[model samples]
Target: MTLPLSGLAFPPSREPSTRVPADLRKQGFGVRIAEQRDLGFMRALYETLRAEEMARVAWPEGARQSFLDSQFTLQHRHFTTQFQHAEFLVLEHRGQAVGRLYLLRESPRWLVIDIGLLPAWQGRGIGGALLRQLQRDAQGSHAQGLALHVRLDNGRAHALYVRLGFREQGGVEGLHQRMHWDVPTAVAQLNTA
Candidate 1:
């Protein structure tokens, strides 16, 4: 199984698993702690997410796979080493793994390191539901807010973040824009309503 997106690798057997809440199940979604066993699935998913970008360069199959493998390894190592306390979560629709959500909990903010779904899983309201829940959790914990970066060309994701109340703070790196959704605003709206 190939994994989706570029992120940390968790050995399945060593970590405990968790089921989504009953409320989420009613929405046809589930969450579980990703396992080492899911690495293949995660890798495959990452490749799929990169397929379009890789196509632009049109590298030979061997070269493309090699490059992706190296980058994946580097990223996974960086994330795991840097954010030792982050949660490596697998997103499931119904019962099958469809995406991954990597979250880093810090003192006053929760960093959404990555959140990507398979092509087939996009635009199904799953991402929205998950983000809303994360927002709620942030508010509950009195965190500053949630923050994430999206590639400049990833219009779909950027739009979703905006619709979820994230404001574009500025650009990051070369081709990414940093966006933030403030928990205080969310709490204020809820209090007013």
Candidate 2:
């Protein structure tokens, strides 16, 4: 079931803040709220991310494109409508849109609705830096922890989350794995670091 953004019952601790960290800004990385103009780039990025999976299918090019379009639309609609309080951010590199990071901060935990980068931007440490910034934000806001779901087949992402102190909390039978990082755990790791 979906709820309008206005229907959200939990008020945010603070307004959405997309301040790009100084270190990231020095590296030409930044983030901003997604806008209507960004929808095209967002759709293209979505397609690029799914290209590998789509390549295995024998469908015609037109059919593949059509399928991706519909899927992106549905996903976009679901996110915007359901997560009323979520922040839909566009990750930028030197002012060019390169990825997205969606988040929702509730009372106890901050949920990473989704985070994705174009294939060209992968393996560049950008994702880790953004996640680290998010961890700090959650801690500052007094959230108990952070939580997210990762595809079971995404070994790279799973490894990153684990390295960042997220532990499996179980999830769908064969699709995604739920993982969490608690504030206490993050604090402990920080003290030792």
Error of 2 at 141 (Å): 1.7
Candidate 1 lDDT over 1-193, as tens digits, reads: 2334435456332342333545778877877788776777777788888888898996787788888887777777777777777788888877889999888778567888888899998888777878888887777675788988898889989898999999988657687888888877658566446
Q: List the residue pairs that clash in candidate 2.
A: none
Which ranges of candidate 2 are over 4 A from the true structure? 1-15, 185-193
TM-score of 1: 0.83
TM-score for all predictions?
0.83, 0.85
**Local error of candidate 1 at 37, Å?**
0.5
- Largest lDDT belongs to which candidate? 2
